[model samples]
Target chain A: MSSAYLAAVGEDDSRGGWRPTVDARMVRLESAVEAVLEPHRARLAGADRVTIAPDVHYPFHPSTGVVTDPAVVGAVAAWLDRELGTDLVVVGRSDDRIAFDRTASYLGYDRLAERFDAALVDLADVPTRNEYRAVDGRSVALSVPKPLVESPVIVVPSLRPTEEGTAAGAVRTLGRLVTSGADSSRASVAATQMIDPDLAVLDGTVAYGDDPVATNLLLSGSAPAVDAVATSLLGRDVDADVALSPLLSDGERPVAVENPDGVDLSGVRERLTGGRLPPSDDTHPAVSSAYRLYAAASGDAVPPQLEGR
Target chain B: MLSQFRGRLTDPKPLSIGVLGVGNIGMVHLKSALAMPGVEVLAAADAVPENRDRAERAGVDRTYDDYAALLAAEDLDAAVVALPPFLHAEAVERAAEYGIDVFVEKPLARSTEEADRMLEIAERAGIAVGVDHTLRYQPDMVGVKSAYEDGGVGHVPYASIIRLNDGPLGRPPADTAPPSWPLDPNAVGGGSLLELGVHCFDVLEWLFGELEVRDATMGRTLEIPVEDAATVLLRAPETGTTITLHCGSYQWEELPEVNTRLRLEGITGTITNRDHLPKNFYADAARAALENVASRVGGEPTVFGPTFYLRAHYDALADFCEAIRANEEPPVSGLDGRRSLALAETAYDLAAETVAEDVEVPEVRP
Candidate 1:
């Protein structure tokens, strides 16, 4: 049976809000991360070099629960540096939108790296290697970065739903690292298999439902298993997700959290389910259609922003 | 000095124009100049090659990689200084050297001191300096002003204006890396107050003359170097209106739906910009399209009306061109821009004072 563990910080009554103190929160996050990963300590200790891939697709303020809090990554790095004495790297990729180093600096990763003695590595700069992995029935090929392929990766994803209404879990986070010619869901599954991250630490300190909520919990386990639980919690049907279905096709008995005691799992589900990112596109289809019809009849130039995305 | 330029202004064939920056707003001004009847877009310059390409695509006659080179090469009546705040002074200075009048983008300079120096240079060079403060040109604002002047709402007691947009860090599926200058205090001078509130100050003064800054506050939603949000209280003595103006760069703004609110509370009722705006944008756009089509079918001059907000930008630029052609002072002159900057400086000073006072006070009871 697939198992995960949850370690929540702060009291049940203290859950309504969070203080904006990063240093204090990092202290709690370090303890919570330690607790969640305690069972898999042996697996982590055996790996010589480690890399963390966090959900930092944008430079959204961490307090908004839109990106993984740099403090969470710092806490984990601090633990690894002290306990395992492993050379650590925090990895993200640069896209056409924004450079990874700029995103890191804006989101406070530069300072966090300095404090924890870890290197912030943009995977886009690293040399890449092509690898093939079968996910579901397709032979998907992924050109993953050399650093991620060489090291034991621990995916640290924030608790949030993507624009497509699926949980932007460990799988999709890993999917962003490599270049794949396949559709998003297929690429996600292929990338996750090739990397086979040793663990996933979900930073639920502040979770994004329809808005941000201070959940202040950390959950960790095998990347796929943890993601399965995450999808279920987010009210996303596992079968509907192309990325999750292939990875969890074994029907691993409903996630049995080894230490879910004292935490209201049902309450967490109720709070975060039915959540989605804000609309991030051009004019609505109805509006666009009306404008197009008007333009055809009037010979008026269409506004560029309202034109085809 | 004025007599020397009088010959050039009247002997003008078509008013020759050059655009200094072809970024977002720069392109708008460039397109407006191109569409104008008596304006000839001679050349355009931008630091970014892509922006220069866009200007060329917009059908400009020439493109220059540097504004200084363009100013030196092009013999033009007027130039549009659409560069960032830091470059505004330098661009104007270059135009002044060429004896060319300039229409500068908002926040006329990094500070009022910079603006004063730039204006002095223009004064000695015998050139006109016009500021682009477009809020006063928007249809809804025009409607509000017309109604208030006609006493549609009797003596106004209080008023409030709010302007907000996603600032340097834009909203949503982040597509581009936002320019860094806007968030840096040194590069742009202050934040939301200068970025947006300058327009509010100009428009407010246009409605209710000469405002006195009473109290103000500034805040930041993020850890950026500059304040993203600012609120100021002012008293317009002439109109006896107590006004509250709040401008922020922290709010997410979507296209087609802007976040600018202006309301006038009077003895009888309230006058709001909402009443002037199109109730349903799509429906109104369709109506405007129909009107334009009918005008075309009838062989009548097309009004090219509606999309009223963007039309304001075109109108603002057209007014600048007309001012240059007539050799008359611009509707919004360099002094108007300086006045707005001075008011913003006052608000900043008052806000700092409030903070100092708060820190100085100690608790009496232990």
Candidate 2:
């Protein structure tokens, strides 16, 4: 009965994949967002306080399709405030790498918050409640933030692959907001169940496959269901993803899109499949090994960047 | 060994060196010194136990928890001052008291005043002070200079240099905790200008001669305490060239593909650093490795091969060590470091003035 909706907006005529101008991208994003959310508008109208959790783990330039564009969040906020008349909070968490508030500011969420009369909350600063849930037959405990627990949550994650070689979907985006005693996969499942977000809106205006691509589309549905579709689109086997395997039934057919329009789903899958995040270590292991071997032979000091590999 | 050279004695032995604060870049200096011929890495100092562990793994004979202790305990020709900017002054002063020459990492001190005091002490103690301004040592920059000097870009009227990377908060997958001092204004004195712009200032001067800070602007992409991005307009009076230098820590950088671009719009044509860079990083690295191996077989000097960017650090340290051995001023001396700091300070001031001028005044009440 669950279905993910896809809506394409703007022209895609450029030889090497067309990217809409900023104005065109925004207009199209809002149209796509409106179309995707049309099916869930009834539930959205009933919510009082709604919090939008986004893939804002770092202040990576939004144009790279690495992080959710704040413009999309702004458009979503404007529509929610106008149509649903709901109090909104744009939520993220501060980790060791960067503060969520700083990341949001860099991604232009501060102006978005001001323009939409929304609160920019760092989940780390919020009070948390301990919740225990069983994921994959393992007991997982999560210290989920109060704002996310008490509000109607809408997860807006960027279309990208995580370092663990899985789609960083709505569930993982929500999981990143909480403190978990479980491993990443288990933690993501537990947090998603505890939060039970009302909607998952993917910011696929730009997507990071092997590289950034201008997909210029938005898709929305149930958080876990949408993530299942995202998993397939990212060319990942659901059984291979620890988070998706436990959460989604193995026999569940490929999530059928409610409205496909003139979009090329197979083309989208082909372009985004087999994509992975860039290496986050000091240097590649092979390069390090080669450098060390070379250093031994040449009696040259190994560069520190090559050390500790 | 301790009594061999009580203070500045001419011992025919190879230059014995100590590395203080073997963190990321410090480790690079430590390893570079370790690999250089006729130099000994006597000891290394770091506050972090993990860093000391890394230093040991890199073959340092002795390690100290504090740099002051290392300076007090070791017998060495020079020390590499690779501590944070706040500690740079103290580290240099300690080296000075022990009559040990120093090669410090960039942004020589937190400010020009602190650098002046450090340089004065080094001068009084008769110790050489070398600053690791490694841009000049980089092959691409060197190639640009060589081409410019060769009149390949005849009478360049304008030039622009851009250097950007994901600053303290590096790009995802968010591997390590970014050090806090880099973002704190008091701790580091300034942001990208001091951390990265200083390097540009040093390189610009090297390329165009004395540069005059014209108009400037600084921006923070985030609400962090310091500006993460800076753009400065400069005029090189000697070369009669207008230059724009923009540096930021906001861009995401994946290695082997650095985002440093240098372009010269000359009277004849455009000359770019890209023209000299290796077509393929890994291929060039492999070639460098093979050449170094061949050199080893031939009993010739082995250049720091494999990485073009890292080779500069090696060459810079090698130059400093050679300068100390010859009892001469370092090629990139303390004064050169101070000069870059002065230029950055001017840029900051000019940027602040621009901001003030742009501020709108309120209408007078009736």
> Interface RMSD (Å), each candidate?
3.4, 3.3
- Model 2 ranges off by over 4 Å: A5-39, A46-48, A80-90, A94-146, A178-183, A237-242, A245-270, B1-11, B297-303, B359-366
Chain A alone, TM-score per model: 0.92, 0.92
DockQ computed for model 1 against the true two-chain complex using alpha carbons:
0.33
TM-scores, each model vs. reference: 0.85, 0.86
Each prediction's DockQ against the real complex? 0.33, 0.42
Q: Following a full C-alpha superposition, what root-mean-square deviation does model 2 have from the true structure?
A: 5.3
Model 1 alpha-carbon drift over 4 Å, by segment: A7-50, A74-89, A126-152, A179-187, A205-217, A249-253, A257-276, A281-309, B1-12, B147-158, B265-270, B297-304, B349-358
Candidate 1 local lDDT, A202-276, one digit each (tens):
888888888887877888998878888788778789889888888874657567787554677778899989988
Candidate 2 residue lDDT tens string, A1-309: 467888875544354443323334465567777888888898788888899988898877777778887777877887898889999999999988778777777667777788778999999998999989988777888899999889788999998999988999888898888898788878989998899898999888788998888777788988877888788878988778887667666455557787566677678889999998877757778878878888788766677776663
lDDT of each: 0.83, 0.84
User: Compared to the true structure, candidate 1 yields what TM-score?
Assistant: 0.85
